[model samples]
Target: MTDFVDNVAFIGLGAMGYAMAKNIRKKMAPTGTLYVFDVFGRVCEKFRDEFKSFGPIVIVESPKEAAAMSQTIISIVPGAKEVRDVYLNNNSGVIVAPKNEDRLIMECSTIDSQSSREVGQALGTAGTGKYIDTPVSTRMQGGVPGADSGTLSFLIGHSKPSDTDPISHRLEKVATMMGNPKKFFYCGKLGAGLAAKISNNYLSCSILLAVAEAMAIGIRSGVDEKLLHEVIQNSTGQNFMADVVQPVPGVVPDAPSSNNYRLGFKTQMMIKDLGLGVDAGYATGIKPTMAEAAYRVYENAAVDPKCIDRDGSSVYLHITTTQEDHQE
Candidate 1:
């Protein structure tokens, strides 16, 4: 394994990945190099112009190119299909890149476990490098705010316990560059992180819907929404959404709800993750009733003009504004 990390590659420069790469580039050693890549050439150009002075920023052409020049590679793409294309694509993927026994590849996307395991197996068979699933949890911490502050928490699924091996120890150190040091979890084997993330997202999405419905009920009963929020925080009904990322606007001054839901977790992304959770539940023979209910709400919000591109919490707007609810 590499004793020191001086060259790192970061793929996928979307909402979360952009902020994470920014922190990595800013905090990296002055002598180190940061390789960046995205499907959009302009995004890579913009990132380089904005942060080139901080450190060496090289915009690569593809995932393989990034992997060829770095000892450690990190990716946080959108979905399972993108995950496969980045790591397993025949012509331009990381699997065909130059082999380095010491290289470590981390996929931080929130995706299905089967797809993650398939990529992990291919990397092991090709002897490309070590692979880990490292989906992040940042909604309660203010989503993009958490990523920008380097305070996001990750659910890591690796071959060994964190810090138990040279590779895992290296993983722990690198993860801290983009996440809270105390919050990264070493959940079991290579695909455990994805499973944990899917289950957790299912619950959080459900919670957001629950909070929204509860708050709407309170407001309709002549109670001030702010007072309702205060009461919930002081009572057992309190949750991360109610207190930190309140579904009701004006309840939390800095929440996405207060800012019209732009630049936060998108409703479509929420729908995708919820569908993944529901699929996992059916695959495991357990019926996720609450997740099903929340999934329907998010799906509806994804199609609504007012909530389509807004934050996941904007389901509050969908619920309050809709005159009729679709029956399951």
Candidate 2:
């Protein structure tokens, strides 16, 4: 174990985090240590075995251990509750770690803006670290593949929005370790990252449902599925979901639709994120008509056994089979 200057820590070894951490470890200096933590011990072990050759990968027991030892901490957990647990759970959370002003904490989950603010406030008061919300996104429906390929975009919410701020430069330097440099957006103050993300997802999920419904109508009207999709792709109706992540099977050969709608963002999680957008809309006194409608469809689809654990686009299958549609 050689002494290194840029020791960094990453938490959450789930689908997105695993790939993000893998890229971080691969891009890290040979001597720098990459500390990782996850609630599942097996995931940590697997990550170490798989990526240790890229750099020194240290598997720690808790967020405290990871934060205590690293100059920068990046986390992308499941949801708000898990986010609070990893950062606020007194005994083991990162909040209890030694106070280190130089330590920069970046959370990359697409949780509610409120939770991001809560953790940011707690970190500020505790003086453990500086907290920034950095929720991940990508062009089109590039989910896991975006993380794996290191082309993902990050929405950053830092205290200093100025491009010349030393802290902002530092944020980008570390963020580009797992994201595209040109694709980074410093979306304003803390909580703004999630605000941007929730808004993006609100539109993305709505488009997903719209695409699903349009495809259903076309197919039911005797238009060939792939042909209808191709027409839409070349016509005015095309969008990312239509061209890149077509929900219709055989339209996109490698999409989740072709793979039984598995290994993508789950329908239940889509509902949760949509609900976040809907709640934000109400809180801001703006009616999110399309988001609310999409939310209802996803909520009902999530309860169906066939679509519950499938990809969010599985709503296509649900709509075609269930005979329920949202309309004028």
Candidate 3:
């Protein structure tokens, strides 16, 4: 077909995974063959249709089927549990499949550091593949453009390292070819990238929660919402949360808050990442005091029907509105 990348496959059709695979097929044209598998058959079929113009797309039944067809695989799933199931599960997982070859496995999911290492270790033990975690972050409020336009950032670490190595270079090459080369940060060691991502997200959720609280206080205290944001954004209080998330809708233009929090990172996903950080804290004997507080707030919000399918930034609105409801 276009160009045969029979060696490359993607193992998930989650929002980001689907979009990245679709765009990579179009732009990179991986051997006119980009094998794909998803737990959802409909998503796989839909992607198979949409991706045909760029390459030969296969809708496989299991992770093993996808692995059999490609020498390089990229997995972008929801979290650690799914990651474990897809690559390590004995029944039909990739590593346990018969006749598997040495492949490059790049994990782009936002999984915990522990899981990353565990998966990497398993691959090593099984002699199945070279594993690397290049967990990425982006404002996925938009669609494929978020990945295609080079807006996503990749944080990477490999299970093995050497000055002159085969695997990491290939991992870097494919990532650079498929994504924005400039956005990648190659952290050392297999689990370093995941640790970095957890810390980064911990700060993100923590600050977003604080921004929500501060914005609610400002609005209730008679400070003009727009004016208060303008002042704070230009002052020492500014962060991505206030500057971008803008918990108060009218304060920022084109923000998720302004759009009813649709099409942005989901509120529950934020709590899930926070949970990973909290788990790390317990493992390391360090208390993630602020993260625990942020976790509690988002945990409470995640269960609220009001926050369902809402953007993570909606946590600010949830806190403010709940407080007002209690006071009333």
Candidate 4:
């Protein structure tokens, strides 16, 4: 395994990717070279200019180009299909190798475990590029430019142990570049990372919806919404639903909920993840009632223009308002 401190490629210049790449540039020593690629040319250019002070910035034309130029490639695309298309898909609709065997490919997208396995298998067959799933667990606000200092938990699934593969060690470095390193578990296989992420998100969605429904009941019973939030905060509920993960607004000032659901994590994104969870459950013959419920809640919220602008936290408002109106 080669040191990832020097050459790095980051794909997908969306909110999360942009901030993560910037942090890598700021923290990496030995004057790291950053190769960035985004479908939008404007985004690539903007990042190039913004991080020019760090070191050499290569704005690549495509994922392959970026892969060709860097030793370690990190992808934070939208979903599994996009992840496959960028890393495995070739111009001729076939999968091709990006570089040599020592090269590391870290996929940071939140996707299904099965699809993650497929990508990992393809990379294995190529006998060159290594694949790892290192999905992030932080709201967009947490990844904002200067807010890189904020903490984030990582679920890393590497193909092999760090002692065996130098690539695994380099990935740990990349993980810390984004935020304070939480956990970089060497989950047994390639798809394990995706599995962990899917399960985590499913439970998160379920908790959010459950809290939302409970809070809505409080609102309908004449409890002030703000007061309800405060009461919940002071009670045992605060341990999990309120403190570790808040579902309602004004509870955590820095959370997406407090900001009226703007630019944290979109409801649509939550719906997508829930959908993935549902599919995973069905395939594994496991009950997914909570995931299904969360999906429906997000599906309805996505249709509302106001909710569309709000963060995933806005699900609380939907639950509260709907339940309150029912009683009226």
lDDT of 2: 0.86
Candidate with more favorable, higher TM-score: 1 or 2: 1
Task: Please provide, for model 4 over 54-79, each residue's C-alpha lDDT reduced to its tens digit, 9 standing for 90 to 100.
Answer: 78888887777776667788878888
Distance from true location, Cα of 134 in model 3, Å: 1.3
lDDT by residue for model 1 (87-144), tens: 9999999999988766888899988998998999898888888889988885754267
TM-score of 4: 0.88
TM-scores of all candidate predictions against the true structure: 0.93, 0.91, 0.92, 0.88
- lDDT string, candidate 3, 1-328, tens digits: 1112446779888878877786667755545578888888899899888778777787788888777777788889887899999988898888776544358888898888988999988987887777888888755322334665545678888543355785666676677655666767778888899888888888888998999898888888999999999889889998877887787777788888888876578888888889888888888899999899999899889988778788888887678779989999
Residue 110 local lDDT, model 1: 86
Error of 4 at 82 (Å): 0.8
lDDT of 2 at 187: 79
Global local distance difference test of model 3: 0.79
Please identify which of the two predictions, 1 or 4, would achieve the higher TM-score against the true structure. 1
Comparing 2 with 3 on lDDT, the higher-scoring candidate is 2
Which portions of model 2 miss their true places by more than 4 Å? 1-5, 138-141, 159-164, 324-328
Q: Which stretches of candidate 1 lie over 4 Å from their true place?
A: 1-4, 159-164, 324-328
